[model samples]
Target: MYELKTKENDRSVVEFIENVESPTKREDAYKLLDIFTETTGYQAKMWGPSIIGFGSYHYKYPTGHEGDAPLVGFSPRKAKISLYFATGDTKREELLENFGKHTTGKACVYINKLADVDVAVLKRLIEQSVRFLQDTYPNNNTN
Candidate 1:
């Protein structure tokens, strides 16, 4: 069986944010916290050591691998802030087209700062991710 490293934990979200080394990144973390919370209507939780996550869902792969993951989350990393969103959603790419300056990987979008991107588009991405995961894993309780 494979283990997921990014499981949710009881760590304090505020404490994690406060410990962020960069003052700018720390400020951005708080801003993102507010955005994800208001948009998803779910309280933030600490995922792993670094990520601030909102709602969650359980997923099982065809290979019988399964795990719980956050519907949306972000980490203020050393280089850039990584935004976790749903993969395989065509609308995600469509929204990214108008999402201001950002880069995308298989599962995350990277931005230098919140000021570099449109907050409205970020909210849409968060909402779409939550909706996609909810629809894909309907039985998984969120929040």
Candidate 2:
């Protein structure tokens, strides 16, 4: 059985943000916290040691692998901020076209700062991610 390392925990999100070494990253973490919260309409929770996540969903793959994951989340990392959104959404690729400056990986979109991206587009990405996960995993508790 494979274990999920990013499981949600009881750690304080505010305390995590305040402890961010970079003042700029700390400020950006706060900004992202507000954006994810208002957009998802779900309170933020700490995922693992670094990710500030909103909402959650339980997923079981056809291969019998199952785990819970956040609907959306972000981490203020050393090099760039990582934005976690649902993968396999075509709409996500389309939205990234107008999302200002950012780089995408399989599950994370990296950005230098919130100022470098359009906040409105970021909100839409968050909403789309939540909707995609809820629709894809209908029985999962995504809220």
Candidate 3:
């Protein structure tokens, strides 16, 4: 069985933000905390050691691999803030087209700062990701 490293934990979200090496990143983390909280209507929880996550859902693949993951989350990393979102949603790509300056990986969106992105679009992305996951894995949520 494969283990997921980024499981949710009882660590302090505030303490994690406070320890961010860059003051600017720390401030942005707080701002992101507020935005994500208000948008998701869920209190932030620490995922692993770094990610500030909101809601969670359990997923099982066709191969029988399964795990729980946050609906949406972000980490104020050394180089850029990584935003987590659902991977297979076409709407996610459409929204990212107007999401201001950001880079996307398989499931992570990277941005230099909050100013570089539209907060409204960010909220939509959060909502869409949560909705998609909840629909995909109905009744399996830890929200």
Against the reference, the lDDT scores of all candidates come to 0.92, 0.92, 0.94
- Residue-level lDDT of model 1, residues 1-143, one tens digit each, is 57789999999999999998899999999999999999999999999998889989999889888999999999999899999999979999999999999998888899998999999999999999999999999989667
Give RMSD (Å) of candidate 2 vs. truth.
0.9
Candidate 3 contains a number of clashing pairs equal to: 0
Error of 3 at 29 (Å): 0.5
What's the CA error at residue 109 for candidate 2, in Å? 0.2
| Leading candidate by lDDT | 3
Models 1 onward score TM values of 0.97, 0.97, 0.98
Residue pairs in steric clash, candidate 2? none
All models, RMSD in angstroms: 0.8, 0.9, 0.7
Full candidate order by TM-score, most accurate first: 3, 1, 2
Could you tell me which residue pairs clash in candidate 1? Answer: none
Score candidate 3 by TM-score against the native: 0.98
- Per-residue accuracy of model 2 over 26-70 as CA lDDT, tens digit each: 999999998898898999999999999899999888988999999
